[model samples]
Target: MLLAIDLQSETPIYTQISEAVIEGIAKGQLQKGEALPSVRTLAVDLGVNLHTVNKAYQLLKQGGYVQINRKQGVIIEPNAFPIADEAFKQRLWDRLKPAVAEGVCRGVKREEMMILLDEIYRDLNKM
Candidate 1:
């Protein structure tokens, strides 16, 4: 899988790296059980410090999107995607509330927001 980072972005490099991997998985570019590039190799390829790559991998692990093993390196989680629990729903709402509120403040109609959400859902499913 190919990963790209924007050196000039306000987001941290580690966050960009982890998000890229997550997007790759969602886009079906990286399959479950696939091994990611080694930390040192990826750092060299991205012209970043090895610690940055390692931090990204750690984030992926904490997010349950990947697993790291001494012998196997980093691999995508093999289990099915997690179902949203109550806690997860709460967290989702917490994240979405601000964006939805911003839309409301901008005079975005509910129907327009629904259509936009539907479009995003469809695009993700298409991948």
Candidate 2:
């Protein structure tokens, strides 16, 4: 997968790496069971430290997006969609609350927000 990073961004490099992987999956650039590059190789390619790549991989694994195998390296996980468990819902709410609040504060209409969400879903589904 092709991953890019913005060194000047406030977000951490590892977070950016993990988000790129997630976007790849959403865009169908990555498929289930697809093998990812070794952490060291990815770090070298991205001109970052090994630990940064490793941390990104670990986050992906924790989020159920990838799996790490001692002999096989890393691969995308099957059925990696987010579950609707309470914990997942809570976390989703926690993450969205700020953005939604900001939208409200900006006087964004419900229809506009819904349209934006639909556009994003359509974009992802186009993969």
Give me the candidate number with maximum TM-score.
Answer: 2
In lDDT terms, which candidate is top? 2
Show the colliding residue pairs in model 1: none
List, residue by residue over 12-78, the lDDT tens digit for candidate 2. Answer: 9999999899888888999999999999999989999999999999999999999899998999996
lDDT of 1 by residue, 22-71 (tens): 88887788899999999989999999999999999999998889989989
Global local distance difference test of model 2: 0.91
Q: Which sections of candidate 2 miss by over 4 Å?
A: 79-82
RMSD of 1: 1.8
TM-score of 1: 0.85
Off by over 4 Å in 1: none
- All models: lDDT? 0.90, 0.91
